[model samples]
Each structure stands twice: as C-alpha cells, then as structure tokens.
Target: MEPTPTKETVELTTESGTLRRRGEWVVPRLLRIRSQAGAVRLDMSQARIAHPVVDIELSVLSGSIVLVLPDGATADLDRLHSPHASHRSRVPAVPTHQAPHFVLSGETYTGALRVRYARGHRRR
Candidate 1:
C-alpha cells in the first residue's frame, strides 16, 4: 500500500509591525502571510524546506514584503496582483531541476514585494 502525502501550511498574520522568519526554521509546503501594514520578511537561506515546491499567498494593505531565497532557488509571482504596488525579483522566474521553487499569489496594495537571493549567494 502507498501512503498519502499530507499537506502542510504555515500562516502568519498581523495588522502592523514586522513579521520575520529566519535562521534554521522549518518551512512548510504552503506559507500564507497577511498584513494590514508594516513589513514581512522571510529568509529561507538556511531553512529546511518540506517540499521542493512551495506556494506563498500574501495579502498586504501597506508596507513591504521581502523574500530571501537560497542560491539557485526560483520564484514565480505571475499570479500576484499588485495594482498599487511594485514587484521586484532577483531570482529566476523558471524553476531549476532539483532546486526549490516558490509560487506566490494574492494581492498587495500600496506596498512592494521583493524577491532575491540570500546574502553572499549568487544565482546559479
């Protein structure tokens, strides 16, 4: 008999201030962040990812959101709608073989979403 794969999701919500996740944290398959203001930072440089592919759903009314990925990791933000915000990415849009991939969706109003490689790490 084959075992079924369970879905894991981690959610962070706040009305203001900063929400950060760094160090040696365990990242789930799905991550959701909701904020009415302030900043949201996720440093996945040294974290343990549960899956090869990760889905992130973000909702921010103001402020900024930054995602620092490990080297060779890629992020896809095509499903994100940010009419009054800006989206910047230093990572590749396409996924690399055997590399971690992140898919971002949801909306950001009057804020910014920045995706980049970790410090001292260059794109491969």
Candidate 2:
C-alpha cells in the first residue's frame, strides 16, 4: 500500500520589520503568516512544487505581505477573506480547475497583501 502524503507547514511570526525568502527553493504544503506590525515577502519564482496542492494563510494586522510565484502556477483564492487588504497581479493566473492547485486563505486586518507571478527563465 502507498503511504499517505503528509502536509508540511511553514510559519512566520514576526513582531516588526520584514522577512524575505528568495531563490530556488521547495514549497511547503501550508504557509502561515502572522505579523503584528511587520512585512513578509516570499519569492518563489524558482521554487519546486513537490505536491499538487499548497495552501497559504495570511493574518497580518499591519504592514504588508507579498507572494511571488512562477509564471505557470495556478492560484485559488476562494478561501481568502481580507476586506481591507489588496491583492495585485499583472499577469493572469492559470485556472485552478485541474489537479495542481495553490489555495490562499485567511485574513488581514489592515495590511496590503499582494500575489504576483514572475516569468521563469529558461536554462541553456
């Protein structure tokens, strides 16, 4: 029998200032953000997706939050509930009507939340 896949969780609990993660990395199943008066920025332009589904939960009271994904990544924001927050993206996200999906949830009290997609580079 095949083993069931377990979800991985990455948490960020900062009081002030900014937290940044960049370069080629692997994405976890769940990303939890809880900033009291700080900012968090994750650049996943060269990240590797091990699973088909990933979830990001943001809970920022103040400051700002940003998430950068690859060009072909798909995002599902139906569970996101941020009344006073803003989500910005220049290019259109690939529809999450298929297998692989990235779901974003949770809420922000008085911070700016943005999700953008950057085009990946081709190696020679």
Candidate that scores best on lDDT: 1
Candidate 2 yields a Cα-based lDDT of 0.73
Per-residue lDDT, model 1, residue 61, is 93
Residues 1-124, model 1: lDDT tens digits:
5433545988899889899999878888999899999899999998887688999998889999999998888999999988899999999999988679999999998888899988788544
Candidate 2's clash total is 0
Give a tens-digit lDDT track for model 2, residues 50-80: 7777888887888888787765566766677
Which candidate achieves the best TM-score against the true structure? 1
Q: After superposition, which runs of candidate 1 have C-alpha atoms over 4 Å from their true positions?
A: 1-7
TM-score for every candidate vs. truth? 0.91, 0.78
Distance from true location, Cα of 12 in model 1, Å: 0.2
Q: State how far residue 1 of model 1 sits from its true place (Å).
A: 27
Where is the poorest 10-residue window by lDDT in model 1? 1-10
